[model samples]
Target: MFKKLDFFLFGWIINWMYPEYYRPKYGYQRYYILFFHYLIPQKLFRLNPKVRWPVHFTSKVLAAENIKKGILCDPGDNNNNYIQANNGIIFGSNIELGPGVSIISSNHKGNNLREHTKGKPITIGNNVWIGANSTVLPEVSIGNNVIIGANSLVSKNIPSNSVAVGNPCRVIKPKEDYSEDLSVIIFNKKIVEKFDVFLNSNV
Candidate 1:
């Protein structure tokens, strides 16, 4: 039929255009493959063929929303694992998540067997490096430029520019003060003098 042909053509076009984004080397490519193979076929048979492609495309867009908002940090470098992130998570830029890192943003109350749902947002700061197999609990905000050791359980907020380690993750030391603009400290008198106007304005 004409409808079946149209769905096949559209799915093929999507695969060609976004080969890397949908089929990254690190992950299993399960979602991308499923959308085209199983989901599309079922929809075409039962529902309108034209609707199948659009619905699959919308799911991809939702996944991207999670990444851009910093709720789920996937730098295209971490190993693939079954990771789930809900809405309201905020992540900073340049965050590196190692393999098997799980961030849980929702939890239930202890006394209620009926699962009292609580909405907690997880925020990861910029330039953060989370080690492999680490679990970040709900309602936690990790400050910028932090380094978390491997296999650690983060249950609390970590201050900026510190190294945190252990099961319940504790800050080992306070981060040293450094210039954010210039990587190296501006100790040179001439450089400071050259930018005196800019520094004065900032102060």
Candidate 2:
């Protein structure tokens, strides 16, 4: 009974504080855990969060208030993510950022090294998967259904339905069609099959 009451209370508070646009695709229990692990340290102790979404404990998100995210999409959910949304960053649905990913929207001024220039806002489209240790510089717009490979530097705009990689990050090949079905992930493995299939059940 107490467990049920606790879940219900936290669920209500979450729904009140965050609207649908600010929430992840996971359930209430995951949100509660993230609150204790990530949000508490970020908001109360460190005073670093401006959005109420679930961020990993090791991630560093700056100027989160300047970011606008879509439903079921969060950029800094992965480990060791450095998201500097000082100018602005808009994210579409189902964004997957790998470890050590840096999405910086502000650039240092050339005249004054200490000052930052307000560049264009970085906009990421739906179903995009940026690989590990990738750095997306300012004023870049990535289209939908794109995959950026590991250790790439994205300084130019990438169109939809393309697979790009490298230091300067160019479109190497076209991407295939993608499914929007729900998927499940397991620990120490990269599993992204359908959620029902993982549960041995029917959709």
Candidate 3:
């Protein structure tokens, strides 16, 4: 009975302390509220990784210093989700990480598990959506407005404005190619005229 009472009190305190958390409109934001808020044993147990406001994590994370703002991650199993950042990692704004996704920034050298191989920083650009069950390997930089399909393995750097999929994660289509059908504009006449001019200029 005391444990349940304690849990409620903890929730009340977090809700009272961070009132802005009430404004999130996404379904997954509930998961963020539940996990991050509850993960805190007390209001004073602060650590590194220096997470900015509005970021959410549904699983355990290592090397919190490497994480940036606007990252949403959910490790499906929660037990096996391992985020490794031996080098460094930079996440841009509005980046959504699907369930069971692993972003590894370093790898072990040869058969030895003690020594790690040299690797570059993993930089994920803004508006990138990594699908479920995907693994982003070391030294990879994903560009902006990219979508990686489910169960894909990102071994190489992915370019901006592309949809990549499969085991090796190949770009099947560019973002511009998918927008050819959007010919109509519903805006002010002046803005629409300017937009038309811009489109013609590109052509």
Candidate 4:
């Protein structure tokens, strides 16, 4: 088909252009073989196909029709993270998802295995950053410019420009109050910044 040809041609062009930059540790090949092979072909050629490409080939995204642009779904420390959107999930541009983040749009209605499950749509706005090990339940609409802390569970809708944390995921404060180091700086900064902020605010 024309789609297949298109994919192959694109892959070939990529292979021809950058043959030496393949990485094996994170799983990439020099010949663009892995790119075309591991790609979810159906997801790649979906409606408005030219929008974006997933960062990792190992990531599993269900119901691509429900997804939108500029999503960064990365693997966890354990590797192999999942994003499942059964009913409907719409994502705006430039949303960054850290490792071990799970966004589930459908859940079981009852204990019965055979019974039909219930689902609701999840819409995440642009410039939102979800931290590692966070789980987003169904029917949750996360607004734009939001930052979710690591190991948090989001059960309800979060308004734009907020910082939410904890098990039930309450809004801690407005995002403007949060330090840029806390929101954007990921590694080896959590403990020191929190302590520093506590000290400064208390003083």
Q: What TM-score against the true fold does each predicted structure earn?
A: 0.52, 0.77, 0.62, 0.58
Query: What does each candidate score in C-alpha RMSD?
Result: 13.1, 7.3, 10.0, 12.5
lDDT of 2 at 202: 11
Given candidate 4, what's the lDDT at residue 153? 97
Off by over 4 Å in 2: 1-17, 20-29, 182-203
The positional error of residue 27 in candidate 3, measured at the CA in angstroms, is 6.3
Candidate 4: 10-residue stretch with minimal lDDT: 19-28
Which candidate do you rate higher for lDDT, 2 or 4? 2
lDDT of 1 at 178: 30
> Positional deviation of 118 in candidate 1, in angstroms?
1.8
Off by over 4 Å in 3: 1-28, 31-58, 70-80, 176-203
Give lDDT tens digits, candidate 4, residues 99-132. Answer: 7788888886678766436666888875688888
TM-score between candidate 1 and the true structure: 0.52
What are the per-residue Cα lDDT tens digits for candidate 1 across 1-203? 54345436554554443322222222232444545653454354432232212223222122223433321133333443323344445776446677777776656567876663566667888668888888888778999879999999999999998999899999998765333442222321223243344333323
Whole-model Cα lDDT per candidate? 0.54, 0.74, 0.59, 0.57
Using lDDT as the measure, the top candidate is 2
lDDT of 3 by residue, 53-143 (tens): 3222344456656654332222222333456777888775446677778889888888898988876789887567888889999999999
Score residue 162 of candidate 4 by CA lDDT. Answer: 94
> For model 4, what is the alpha-carbon lDDT of residue 164?
96
Candidate 1 positional error at 83, Å: 3.6
lDDT at position 51, candidate 1:
24
TM-score of 3: 0.62
